[model samples]
Target: MAEAQKPDLGPDPSLLILDDDESFLRRLAKAMEKRGFAVDIAGSVADGKARVTTNPPAYAVIDLRLEDGNGLDVVEQLREARPDARIVVLTGYGAIATAVAAVKAGATDYLSKPADAGDVTNALLAMTEDMPPPPENPMSADRVRWEHIQRVYELCDRNVSETARRLNMHRRTLQRILAKRSPR
Candidate 1:
């Protein structure tokens, strides 16, 4: 009998993760690396753009907000550099407007924050035309409210008074909510 041939297993693909949250970025990078990807990490849009310019990865996970600039800019750059790259955009403050923007900028998919490595992996490797199932349990109203408030607060430079004025809420009330942990 003829000897059986072994299947070919090619080298792992490269992955880039861009996020301002250092802890989350490191954790995700380590997880992806363990799952057979050569991972690169950037904490800001500038760094991410630089990385893409130097060497575009086969896959990317980008946070919507960055310290230096919006992640969409990086997404556009990646699209230009490598049109076939699979890119996923992540955001803590998920909004319809931003989701539309991400798609327009060439993201393969958009995922809200708190997504695990498996969810990201599935998104990057998905081949079917069918859409993924909607989240079984979406964020509660209170959680959404809190998230919006927090986003505005951050945009206001973490100034309680400015955030209060922007939201038309009392400064003390804003301070109280900020002090407490986010609601579920």
Candidate 2:
């Protein structure tokens, strides 16, 4: 007699992607679906929360900030709904504090923004005990510095001198950096 096949005991590969960027959200949803996940997407925290309450997925990739509110709120809801769910938080404004908050809020992993579908899939499927692979393209030190300066400039209400003072950088140097396009 033929041997019986054992049933697959893994959780279903259902994924929810929440981001405010319209093009990015649709593109990511399609890519994830092609990669064997049943994907549901939302553009705002309100929509994300409603989706979680209605049908929480086994996996989630949520942006850190949204027009409606913080994505951490959605993460909280998902965690409450599915404690075992694997959630990855994505953010353009990467910071140590927020990354810690994400993990504490039950995120399986935290990734800086512009993370591709492949990265998202890997993060969702990675073993919780294992460390995630390093990013394919980590930001350079110059780029990080530029980003920090830009953030400070914005927070200073775009006052060049104030931003320079806050960053402890020279006013002329700050102007030159601001005039130039962001480094990769």
Candidate 3:
């Protein structure tokens, strides 16, 4: 028998692309739109903010630096205006400090430009994918927990001490978390 059709599990309803560079914005818009997304482009922070206020998109692609202001400011504004909107930050000069700040500020993800359409699309999908059932539903808690531990570990770039510091826990405590998360 054939498998039943799944419901529309697409990225988002629409995309709001913000960048000072017109060519980049246009290309990204065209690419994303071709992939079944509704895309809107804004050339400046003010313009982007205005568009979002009028009609918010499901996701926003932001540049780290803008002609009028910094991209992080735009990220903050977008979060304030539409908390549910997923934000992806773009920067030509990727800084670890900025990446960390962006996450704390509620960015779903960050990418260093010259990113292509595929990278943006994948990140959006990953951020907005349906949540899997929690541990004990189907997947093993140990496995899931280990995955989480690994992700956090990698986020701190495999520095357990730094990861613990970032998590606001003692290094030994973070070690225990990892140990508990590990498969028996």
lDDT of 1 at 39: 91
Give the alpha carbon lDDT tens digit for every residue of 114-182 in model 1: 788877877777754867655556688899899999989998999999999999999999999999999
* Model 1: lDDT of residue 48: 97
Q: lDDT of each model, Cα atoms only?
A: 0.87, 0.87, 0.75
TM-score of 3: 0.63
What TM-score, over all chains together, does every model reach?
0.77, 0.90, 0.63
Pick out the ten consecutive residues of candidate 2 with the lowest summed lDDT: 1-10
Model 2: pairs clashing at backbone N, Cα or C within 3 Å: none
Writing each residue's lDDT as its tens digit, candidate 3 over 66-165 gives 8998777777877888898878898765557879988888788888666787777766666445532222323355655565566678877899998887
Q: Indicate the residue-level lDDT of 93 in model 3.
A: 53
What candidate 1 gets wrong by more than 4 Å, as runs, is 1-12, 134-138, 153-179
After superposition, the stretches of candidate 3 with alpha carbons farther than 4 Å from their true spots are 1-12, 128-184
Q: Provide the lDDT at 156 for model 3.
A: 78
Ranking by lDDT: 1, 2, 3
Q: Please give the ranking of all candidate structures by TM-score, highest first, separated by commas.
A: 2, 1, 3
Flag the better candidate by TM-score, 1 or 3.
Answer: 1
